[model samples]
Target: MNEHDFLLMFSCLPTSNKNEWLNLKTFVDIYNSKHDTNYILKSFPENDNRTSPEPEILLCDGDAKMVIERKVFAFPPSYIRDHQLWHEFHNTFLRQVADIFSDNLYELQIKDVDIPTNKKEIIALAKEIASTVIEYKQEIKNSEGIYSDDLIPWSFFQLSDLEREDSPIDCGVCVRLKISSHFYNNQQLNDSLPMIEAQLIKLLKASAPKFDNYSDCLRILILEPHTKVLNLSINFLSQVIQSIEIPSSIDQVWLATQFERDDEELIRDYYLVVSNL
Candidate 1:
């Protein structure tokens, strides 16, 4: 991530209960609007020594009560570590490349290179990338689109015309990830489905015990996947839920998803799955 973007994302980090209440309120509002039910936020119960396990959010509909247990489906530790390392590598590469190419926009497609976490190795790789771009800039200056051979490990595709204009900072670089046959295989989605199912089962089993105290009230299990790439819907989850044994205490299961518009605006929605509402 760029410095501007890194600052923008982290600076607005969600505090304890304020942001969380807003999120839960949004979900409750959507539920009320769609299902024609009037449920209002009562209180966010505290989890203390007296209450060993408390629901995150409580809703009251006059005489009736609702309990929501929010859970985030997180990525595996190994994947998260790799993702962070890659971001560091990209940032380091940009710092080196910006000094070298200052006037034009270049899209560098790096391939077949194992990204190293060591600072010295990362610096060496970044320098090598900058030098490679400088060496081939003149040879492919006139060409557009992909200009490298199939056997070549990397390809350089200049996105914008080499328009040299006076600017304050260096040029913009958009680095594309390496593409391989393994990424295009049909088995990738198939492999991921099982992982998703396993995660769902684990989350359900872990959260079920929290609802034991709320037997008098309607119990809800809200699962929000930490990613937006997967196309999760009621139908897909319905099929997966058939195999797992849902706890008797859970009255309903809902999947919360976030959608991003072309203008970068975000909209969060909730879909009911395994419902007994």
Candidate 2:
């Protein structure tokens, strides 16, 4: 989702108890309002289901040149008040990962950048991705209690031409394997800030393949539980990119945050953060 439009939605509710937020129709209207009520989307229920369908929460234009998906996750006061939220909220994230890894080439392709040149390798990649999902599930389960004080505990799922087998594509990907806090509490978030600042240096050592043989490509890292990172998300991504062996190949990465608007209830925000760094 676009920042301006999403901010409009977030501004509407501000901060509520989670059960008292605007509906999706209101959100769509608010988002479309900035477009001068362009014919793109008039309203929901009518134009809502009819246009802009991307995988899950993603949105794509007519040409599918750009695909944008969001993870709408916010905690209602009631939901957070009950406690026992750790895995419950994280499992929802795992669900998103499962959905993404299951994507066919068409589902993950990035226009203008990704090419369909290598079908065989693409299939092999998909099969490995599927197995990786199974492996991570067990890993997530096995590593359940352990929390990282410095690292985000992310995973590496894919680094390819948006799942295309083409040899001449420009899409690569990486994964982060932790929830918002990385198993730390409020204090932990505070403590990790400094360490998180050094993420780029860490990623240089992090194991990942070079997508482009001659160089690298457009690398997109979809991170969840971005609610905690906020302004720091871009910095985190920038550092990671800079530390890469060849930073030029990576076009950009997106940080996904699911949050209860500062003021509204029931209306959560699915924010996809894209930065030039």
Best prediction by TM-score: 1
lDDT of 1 by residue, 1-277 (tens): 2221111111111224544576688888988898788998887664432456777777888888888888766433143344455566577767766655545566667652456656567567666666676676666455763444433355565555333232222456666656233321336545667877888888888888878888878898887654322333334544676667788878898776555567666666676667664
Candidate 2 contains a number of clashing pairs equal to 24
- Mark the 10 consecutive residues where model 1 has the least summed lDDT: 4-13
Could you tell me every candidate's TM-score relative to the true structure? 0.60, 0.25
Q: Could you tell me how far off, in angstroms, the CA of residue 154 lies in candidate 1 after the best superposition?
A: 4.5
- Give the residue spans of candidate 1 off by over 4 A: 1-18, 22-25, 38-42, 46-51, 61-63, 74-82, 95-104, 111-158, 161-171, 178-196, 226-234, 258-267
* Residue 259's lDDT in candidate 2: 42
Candidate 2 least-lDDT 10 residues: 106-115
Question: Roughly what TM-score does model 1 have, to 2 decimal places?
Answer: 0.60
